[model samples]
Target: MATNAEIAGRFEEFADLLEADDVEYKPRAYRRAAEHVRGHPRPIADYVDDGDREAIEDIDGVGEAIADKIVEYVETGEIEELEELRAELPIDIADITRIEGVGPKTAGKLYRELGIETLDDLEEAAEAGEVQEVKGFGPKTEQNILENLEFAREVGQRQLLGEARPLADDVLAFLESVEAVERCEVAGSIRRWQETIGDVDVLVATEDGEAVIDAFRGWDSVDDEIESGPEKASVRVGEIRVDLRVVVPEEFGSALQYFTGSKDHNVSLRNYAIDRGMKLNEYGAFDVSNVEDEVAGQRVGERVAGETEAGMYEALGLEWIPPELRTDRGEIEAAANGELPDLLTREDVRGDLHSHTEWSDGNNTIEEMVDGAAAMGYDYYAVADHAEGPGIVGGMGLSDTEILEQVEQIREVDAASDIAVFAGIEANVDAEGEIDLSDEVIDALDVIVASTHSALDQDAETATDRLVRAIENPAIDVLGHPSGRLLNERSGLDFDATALGRAAAEHDTALEVNSNPRRLDLWGSAVQAAVEAGAPIAINTDAHQPSTLEYMRWGVHTARRGWAEADDVINTWELEKIREFLH
Candidate 1:
């Protein structure tokens, strides 16, 4: 059976092909299906083998045709349609399309017209005086392609948040050091803590926009300058392009509103502004009733965006929306109705349900991990070092006997520490759908988080069955990172979240939203699916080191993306409630 990655990859290729063909809505459909399949907790082959396409069709935007394709790929070990598309076009689609202005269609056209099938081919064509010879091509366009092709290949795709965040922080720090940059913030999906990031967008509020732009271009890390303007500057830091927008202090808030966006969310906000007799753009909010440029008799050609984020919201007659809640979810409606869920706050977390110490591969010691949790004002902490099973070849996992011995040590620490230290094991759910720890050891721990650590090759049915079996176990308190996904590296287990969620609800198992930036598993969509099925969630750090404990910010932000509230999460509960719920 083809892995989810393999199937998802082919779909992306098809989507890219359709995009090259300038196919519209269908690309979105295919892309959405690819995301759904890629994130689905079950193997695609199981549904195919069982002749149940309903599971695939049940995905949010997947329909019969896409579901059929998924099944066909599973049954035949290849997608014939994709093969046909490949044979027809047979261009090195991804590589050639990486050039800045080149889309799939442009790539296809260039390939068909100039026989430019590779980056090298395109380069050769550009160098050999072939590209400028094409119908709509020019010298500038060729130069731009030559300039961007290497970058496109180097960046490969959008950087995951894990990879881009440090660079953003460094830039933020550097910008703040600039005298002209009075205030600065990352304004984009990065601020929203989305799992994936395209370009790093930093918005600066400055008294002197030109000075700020000049300072940005000179940023130490900037390797190449893409474009420099009075208001905005784009630079390449390594392979990632960082866009810096400098706005006067007065227009800062408005610029932030314009830049910190999921475009769909911005579109909704802009319409909201329009309905209120105000026009919102990067410059500032304006009243355009009497002007052709959409701003007349109001703050046209003036700056007033940075007075306050609240002021911007006040103009729109809505509450200041938190960046995490900026997705075009229920926030707009909730803000309108004054019914926004009191979101889960960092302070609401009573304990870390999934953590590691020296007993496994974690960097911190047990005493230090407990002390850190206590220092953070947590009422309790569970040391969930890995348990031996399929994935543990040597030192990474604790044996059943070792885990039981650690339970005694946990009791010793619990007796001494001011905070409660719960003994738990991050037990591996083997390919055969069973957790490695024996019932006796499971009964001894205060919490048990069963997770997939091996046999990731299993078909979705097998993976889902494995996880569901563990979820059905009476001792398993939480299911860690439900999808086993590692950002930019691996996608998690292929379990049917709806089905597993139902099972979790029946068995009272919490699904973990791992906060580690690299993982961010049980993503917002999965959390929503689980919540819809009445399954409780646990926002955990899955912290390997003390510093990683702060990863909860990303997790909490991610959970809010799923519309998770205090009531939906176990960590958001008080310590007594947490213990009672687990008990």
Candidate 2:
């Protein structure tokens, strides 16, 4: 059976191929349906398996034609149309489109003109100066393609946190159901919620390692078994590779700690343990203060801790560090000093500070979005649709007049709504850090989220200055996705996080950790810098549809990685407090 991500991924491919083939409106529909499909809480595959066509179509933004394709895909494990598109293009459409400025149409053009079918071919052409000779291709455009080709290759090598995390969840769900398994958890970058991960690492505790390993290897979701042993197994699930290591229940915690590592963090932790006359490893923590033979064996000293992860840290007289904070960025020292932050949890978030609807490129109505937020039990929500500005193609953003009109609609919705609905705009910060909105329009909005959607290639100093200028804007309540980075796609603006953080703090502007899987901007270290500077943070979904509102979970974990506490996040505040801050 296909996962939602897999099924949605198919639709996304379909959209790309359609666009590459120059089919216009259909590509948008397919893309919209893909977004909602990925966001839909229910398994679209289940409906198809049960022969429930009506239920499949019930998913928002899924129309009859697309739903039919989805059903065809779920039932047959392939969509005929998608296969036809793939055969027609016969190029790596997905990989080529990942180039920073390369779109589906551009990929199509490249293929038709230069016979470029892969990144290697494109790179070869660009290097030979052949790309610039092609129609519509300039030296700068060729340079961009060359610059981002490595990023595209890197993207193929790793998985986005959003894409990989769900697979981890499913793996855990299966592992937990095994009777022989005493405990199971994801480790590695996924555990720390890094924006991109190499693979999914799962640690299992069990007396019967063979049974657990067998169960893992035989799991239904396993697309291919790479290798398996009595104690461990590696399997492929779609594009994600999952590795499971089973250990004795007593050593589970230590094994988890050993595996859930940023190499630097583990190295520092091992040295820290050594300083305290303790030895830490995958087996357990042992007190070696009294041991005479320093290199006798692996367990030369008395075992002090191992049964539980908390005990492993507790034995060292430190607060058990949250996995997200295990980045070795002073976390061990902070733990020793009893200064580990009380990190924010999902429950601490009181409202969504950024979201969208049909007013822009969003797929839902304002009422529908507000209801979705209310359903999440939020005290408030902000409908900050994109405002017309740089890089906002297709006239998708709201014009000044349209923004006020939407404000009126938002006000009307707020009047009949159960929660406070704040009308806001995600205004684009231009090359020079100026917002596209007028002073009057800026003042009219309740909260202004200024972001950079263009000029992401600016040098560090220029980028930092641009962001600081935006932060200084009194009406700009939040600097959204301050760096504008897209995981595995583009490393956006190179800016000084500390400087940007301090500027935001001084201007009372909050920094946003965009929860969209592609853009967890202000990711970790950046957010940490902002929080350290006393600047507030907002974990927003940047949700374009109602179902995507659940992306807040990713955002919350991202904030934790940045060591943000509930108080550091503005959306965690009460309604009155947020209103006061906005004012």
Candidate 3:
């Protein structure tokens, strides 16, 4: 059966193809329906299988036409219209649109003009100076396409954290069910919570390595067994590669430390170990101060630490560093000096400032969103739906009148509910960094999250200026998704963080660490820079649906990676303190 993600993917592809074909209206409808389907709480396929087409159509933005397609996909495992459209265009629409400045319209234009159907074809055209000869194409545009081709290729090789993390969880669950498995952990970049992952790595502590390997190879999700050994195996699951390694229980800690490295961190540690007359490897740390033969193997000397990660670190005269801070970014020195930060955790988040409801592009209504927030134990919640401006799609942004009207509705809900509901707007910051909303509307609101929705390709200086102007606005309390980047998709902006952070500090505006897995903007390094510059950070999920609020964990880990403490994040403050800061 097709999952919500699979069905949503089809609708999104349908929208992309329609847009490329120059078909209007329906594309927006399909895209909106796709978003609704992806965020729907239940399995859409279940509705289709039960012959409940009405139930499926009842979904927000899903019409009879989209309902019929959903049914077709669920029952027949394919949508005929989408297949026909693919046949008509016969190009990699996804790959082509992924280029920085290229959209569906541009892809369609290039295909129609130069018969370009893939990245390879587009690259060939750009290299031959044929793109500039085409109408509306110029030297600068051609250069951008060429420059971004490599990034696009790299993007194709990696999967978004949101998509890959669930698969990792499933793999871990399956491995843990094996009788021979005593301990299991996910390692590498996934463990570090990097926004994009190349593959899933699993390490196991078990005496029966062969039994563990056998059990892993027989799992139902294994699409193909790439390679298998007595102690190790690799399998392809869906579009991701999963590797499993097993060692004896004693060596589990050392093995995990060895595998969960950022290469640079491990290199520094190895040198540190050599300086201490010790050898470190996956097996254990060995004291070799008196050993005459250097190449006598790791087990040739007295064992110091191997049973636990902390023990290994203690053996080296350092504290155990958090996984997120294990990036060789002074974490070693900090650990040695006992000065590693007490990184922020999920519990530190008090409320979410950026969210939406049916009044804008969200699936739920105001009452439902408020109820969800109350259930999450938040003291306050802000409904910062999109305001009328650029990139406000599906006519979903609220006008000044609508925002005023929403303020009344929000007050009514706040009076009736246990949790405080703050009326707010996610006002769009234009290319000039000026908000389109009136000062009156901005001041009347409890919070204003200014974000850049369009003009993402501006050069560094212009982008910095635009953002600094937004920060300087007295009405703007937080800068949402400062860089506007989408993981593995778009490099939204490239401004100097130190400059922007300093300006933000001067203006008393908080920088947002958007928790939406796709846009963990103000990523780790940027968060650190902003915090170092004395600018407060706000970790917001930018949730369009209630369930997405759970993504706060990802944002917290990302912030921790940046070395942010609870006090450095404004959201972690009490409701009164938050309101005081806003005022």
Candidate number of the best TM-score: 1
TM-score of each: 0.82, 0.74, 0.74
lDDT of 3 by residue, 1-583 (tens): 5666578889888888888889998887787777667545455777776888888988867888889989999889999999999898887988998776688888988998999999999999999999998899898889878977876776664787777888999999998899999999999889888878878999999999999999999999998676788888988787777989999999999999999986657777888888998888899889988888646776868899988888888899999988888766678999999999988888878898999999999899999998888877888899999999987878989999999999889999999989879998999999999998876787679999999988988765678889999999888999999878787677687676777789889999999999999998887767877888999899988988899888787889889988999999998999999989984
What lDDT score belongs to each candidate, Candidate 1 first? Answer: 0.80, 0.86, 0.86
Candidate 3: the clashing residue pairs are none
Residues 224-303 of candidate 2: C-alpha lDDT, one tens digit per residue: 67667888888878767799999998998888888998666777899999999999998899999999854688777999
Return the number of clashes found in candidate 1: 16
Q: Quote the lDDT for 300 in model 2.
A: 71
Ranking by lDDT: 2, 3, 1
lDDT of 2 at 53: 87
Q: Whole-model lDDT, candidate 3? A: 0.86
